[model samples]
Target: MVLHAVPPTVPRLLTDRSTSEPDREALVVDGVGALTFGSWQRRATGLAERLRQRRVAPGDRVGLRFGAAEWLDFAVAYVAVQRLGAVAVPVSGDAAPAEVAHALADCAATGLVHGGGAPGWTGGWTHATADGDDDTGDGADLSTSDGLAQILYTSGTTARPKGVAATHANVTYGAGARHRPFRHSRHLLHAFSIGTNAAQVMLMTALLAHPAVVTLPQFTPLRFARAITRWSAGTVFVVPAMAMELLAVADGHDLSSVRLLGSAAAPLPGPVAARLAAAFPNATIVNYYTSTEAAPAQTAMTYDPERPDSVGRPIAGGGLRVTDEDGRPCAPGEIGAVWMRSPAPPRTYVGDTTTSGATFQDGWVRMGDVGYVDDDGFLFLVERDGDLVKTGAHRVSTLQVEAAIHEHPEVADAAVVGLPHEVLGVELAAVIVVSGGAALTPPALRAFLAGRLAPHEIPSLVHVVDKLPRNRGGKVDKRSLRRSLT
Candidate 1:
């Protein structure tokens, strides 16, 4: 394998890394298996040949579905599809049959490569196992950097999932051929699902970073803590929900080896970030903000006491701007639409041309989020555009209220949303999961929040549940919550 100064496409990323670091451990999926860079390349090459033999061709869509435990196999299948110049469509192994069918039909997938724990739905597409033997050799010409590489579906918390298509250039951008992505650690651990954008980034990291990527088949606070201790992992990543769970169990684990703790996929509440800082002690807590469509462009903020609420500025060459309803850029501190610009070509929704036009323009991708940029250019997310609570004449940020609610001692988890009301356009409502199942009444909770929040910011109605409803992406499912409340 020949190495380029910078791998221009995803296939070259794998082939070059394998030749350069043949003996290095590339991936370690706990409970499944581990693979060296050389072995990974061989398996991927074999799988690509198999896929070609099955008539998988350039630009053809192929679904690669595997369970969390089978991440190694999933990784191989993903690379193989790219090597054959086919578009890889990855869905979680635990996805519903309906979702699998919908994706296959939507892409008119040519084949499905599955492993243990994959859903049974095939939608009449030819299928094969993700298990590839060690056959070492390259196949037909791989896709160019500008060719469509993959189509990732958004986590549909509010509606049906839409396919977001990306080219090889979009996937390989900023990934260097010679330099390691992370310098502080030799191992990076995360529990992001296989079908998520975060997972794709991690996959790229495994290919380019000096660190060996580590993960569990599934995530539990106890399991996560144990992995850190076992591997002496220096870098760790989690979403806000996972961070909260780790905080609850931090007393039971030895997490002193961690140098960096990153939280992504959602905003890291200030209270949670403060607690995490104390819990990790030596680790620097960082929050990452990005969407599937807007990545590999993102904003990263190292935890700062002064700017606890800001999500930092666009990294390096990326750009972030908040715009008003008409797409005019908003002045600093004015909350409005948030757009992130990537140095690489932008990704767009597949098939939905109207939505694609609205979301992606020029090199900027609209983030579908409501936020403001500080005078210093740090971005502060207020709420999802649709989730902002408008009651009477005021606009209330659900995130602000939720952050305050999280400050309460007895609140374990909570979600705030605007419910329909005859008098007001919408009334603020809250559903909370109390810690230790403590009896928390609506009035008592209101009194607790009175000092911390404005009168209108307080929830007009409150309900206690065992756990807040969440989508597969671990985000609060506001649509389902509203339906249940109404």
Candidate 2:
């Protein structure tokens, strides 16, 4: 089976032609405003032109710090940099000054595009640059498929945030396979924050596809649901937690227009997936699995009740390998580390090629996740290898506890980890979010897990938190949880 390759001029193909058709609705921000295809092209081109005036030449890096909701601005800046053959580096809007400074210096970014009053930057462009002329040339040479397009900083769940360098071709190809088919006139809604590669891909795909995107400043179930209803959007992408929040608010809202719901960033617990399927009976609920470094929708499990745990088969043009510790293939039902190889994989880490080499080997990227393939070829993730907890003589997968706890009807969310212990070496611990008015205690949780898990696997410590600490990407911040415990 041959993997599909993304073309070198994919970006140009998506943006240039769409921009030429002026009156077409190119983008829409829920509470902000809207932009026509012609306006989007001219503005983005002007931004590129302004960057050139600032001496941001080909190969230079431009740091973008803004909320995810600013899709129009991000699209213009991103395409502008790409048009000039420069790299766009997007960091979270809420990143600390030190983190922002590190990314700017690390990527050797020549200019910065941020929201008004963004902290810690001495000088750069803002929306003021949106009106400049297209000085980068109306018809400049097209960028190579392998040319660096952006550097996305990881969430740093275990260590410092690392810059994942993605090429234009890699993103274009990945987007091609993962992009949900929507017409140019289709209205869409998504939370903004292009810091993560998954979100970036969604933004670019929306722009390239010429769909009118409705950006939400932040995710609030009511606001998001209102936007979908207001715009009559046919599609939307969000994490499982966000979906659950929407379901909670869906009580009084009409969501019949939303036909496609894509869930990613974290595992969509089976219960949540089931609830979403029931609520959006006509919509296709897709649970996707991929990392910031690899891009979106690499693998997905559509709302199929028969295979609730499967993350589905690989998307076209992507390949998966379940390998043992030594990097050999594992047979069906045999657990192993999940590795993926794509034609457009990240070439290197922005500041550290050594670490990049360590992550990518012989063209295959290690996901740092442990799971196995069944005889039917579906992938089931057990837990992140980094999150594995060891206790006494046993290696416990935290996901096992998480899954078991999530199975409880009163539980809304759950995260499991290993806490420092004196006698057991390390003991299992859990932080859970329970439904309102539900009573949850350590002893009660222990009893719930009695027969489902081994005595040792039962969480010895349980804490009920209002909400789990999640980074901008929406994954649980286990590192922060551990720090809080200490």
Question: In candidate 2, what are the lDDT values of residues 1-486, reduced to their tens digit?
Answer: 112354554346446545456677766767776767666666766666666767777788888877655666766777777777888888777788888888888777776887654554774544333433433346464456778888888888877888888777767663443344565238877774668766776766565564666777677888998888888878788887788677767777777887888888878877788888887766888988888766632788897878777787888677888988787899998888898776565556776866777578877788878888989889988878766788998878787678788778788888987889999889887999888789988798889899789987888899999999988777888988988886
Candidate 1 local distance difference test against the native? 0.86
RMSD of 1: 1.8
Q: Against the true structure, what is each candidate's TM-score?
A: 0.96, 0.91
Tens-digit per-residue lDDT, 1-486, candidate 1: 344564378778777778878889999997678989898888888878877888888999888888888889888889889998899999988888888888888888886888855645546555555454688665765778889999999998756899999998889887754457667888899999988899998998888787899999899998999999888899999988888878878997889989999999988888789889999989999999999989989999999989887899999589898999888999999999999998888888888876888788898898988999988999999998766778998999999898888888777778899999999899999998887758888999999999999999999999998877776567888899999999
Error of 2 at 99 (Å): 1.4
Q: Which stretches in model 2 have alpha-carbon errors above 4 Å?
A: 1-6, 9-11, 123-128, 131-142, 174-180, 183-185
With candidate 1 superimposed using the best TM-score fit, by how many Å does residue 407's alpha carbon deviate from the native? 1.0
* Every model: Cα RMSD to truth: 1.8, 3.4
In candidate 1, which residue pairs clash? none
Question: Which candidate ranks first by TM-score, i.e. highest?
Answer: 1
TM-score result, candidate 1? 0.96
Error of 2 at 337 (Å): 1.6
